[model samples]
Target: PETVTAFQLQKQGSEGSSGERALGQQEGYRVDESGKVYLPFIGEVQAAGKTVMELRQEISMKLIAFFPDATVQVRFLNFRVTLIGEVARPNAYIIPNEQLNILEAIGMAGDFTPYARRNSVMVMRERNHQREFVRVNTQDTTLFKSPVFYLKPNDIVYVEPLKAKQYATQGDFLSRYSPIFFPLVTLATFVLGLSVR
Candidate 1:
């Protein structure tokens, strides 16, 4: 129960099954870049800036105005988010529902690696041709409340690794540091012991 409550902030995504979906846009029609989508009997519908659920209701209302016996559904087909950086897999994933959020987006990208800088991740969003950035820390419990937590179409997530990534030769770097740090600490302790004695 607690796990789900924690996950609920971003649980719109289900574990992806391997298969290709049949192509159709019956949920709700999308307005193009020109902001217009054709509904079955509702003519052209404008759907930009509205959530999937909102769009569905709007289309349903329009359909009902004419035919009370008609049933209609609306959803997004091309809506997607892109993830990059220290994740195990970097890719774009389509959102299956209007409820899809940032965690779902990350899950679609195959999750993060051990090296991922959980505190250094950033999200980029575009609205009205202008871009905005939101920083997120996966280590924090309140991350779900962040504006980036709720994704928009075409959002980009970037996960940076710790500065340790800069040390391409880790063994070499460790060897150099260990040799210096080990003796330095030991010598300091030894000197303190002698003075106390």
Candidate 2:
């Protein structure tokens, strides 16, 4: 069951009601570990493992006792994604809206670095307490149709570094030590020259 962040209650004729008012507005309501969200007048409703529409309907039904003319709208406020490994700025980002795609997530992370393997981007997701992994290739036109292309809340995108990046890092390490190695070699060469003389 997904968590519920906030809900909107539209009272048909309530005072000061300008269309709809966000119910449980302050910080929004979080579905407790017990898989329930407490509404103002409806008490608690099972929210976990249910879609926004399903929860909305449930809340609407519960509200029939209090406000028969009320309409409810529910949504998730904690929808987020994590971008890591070879991206320009890898971090977890909260999505204001539900709809998110792999490209948009990557872009939010400042796009992939030059070392990133564009053809082997990995997406890790968890569902029903089970984890799954999928690879995507941004270079392929078919990737747009892949199910993993649309990222889910808490989805992790990892851009693997290219082999060239590994070699380049190794080369950088050697270059940093080159100044120390250079002086030693020059001193050794001078000593050898005097010994030969």
Candidate 3:
């Protein structure tokens, strides 16, 4: 879930005033599952497809009638991204600010794992009610200027594992069951040794 904070400011005097004071400390509005923000007098307003600036403008226009000098500053409270697959820590992170590059997000996940494929990193993003996938190469310098370089809210970074890692996992499965098969072979060898003696 995402939330927005609206900072309301009002001019001091009815006439032109150079000074302004905050109406309150801060007013937080939670974007519900339906993607709408509920205001005091405005009821529910759709906040999903709108940017922070747009939401601010909409809210300011709605409140202008009640508070003539009202001005609003809207900002998203949480910027979340998920790192999965071959990263050191496969988990979701809440970024402190809105601007976060792909490398920075990877660093927050403790970098990639030993088996991570640096050339084939995948970024899954959801924008404007649609999901999209992008491939980024960590080793390439061009990644810096890529459109997908900057991550957005609810973005997912997936680092693919190398072939060696997949083979090692298969080897592990056999190793886990080897003890059960090993004992039977050892018993047959012991019986053959006794018969030969």
Clash number for candidate 1? 6
TM-score of every candidate: 0.67, 0.76, 0.66
User: Model 3, range 52-85, lDDT digits (tens) per residue?
Assistant: 7888899989988867887676765546678889
lDDT (tens digit, per residue) of candidate 2 on 1-197? 12222344333222123322121222356678788988775678899888878888888888888677886667666666888999997877666565889998888788989999999999999988899999999999999999899988789899999999999999999899999989999999999999999
Give the winner by lDDT. Answer: 2
Instruction: State residue 162's C-alpha deviation in candidate 3, in Å.
Output: 1.6
Question: What lDDT does the true structure give each of the candidates?
Answer: 0.71, 0.79, 0.78
Runs of candidate 1 exceeding 4 Å displacement? 1-30, 169-197
Clashing pairs in 3: none
| Model 1 lDDT-worst window of ten | 19-28
Error of 1 at 39 (Å): 2.4
Mark the regions of model 3 whose C-alpha exceeds 4 Å error after superposition.
1-27, 68-71, 127-130, 170-197
What lDDT does candidate 3 reach at residue 170?
91
The most accurate candidate by TM-score is 2
Off by over 4 Å in 2: 1-27, 182-197
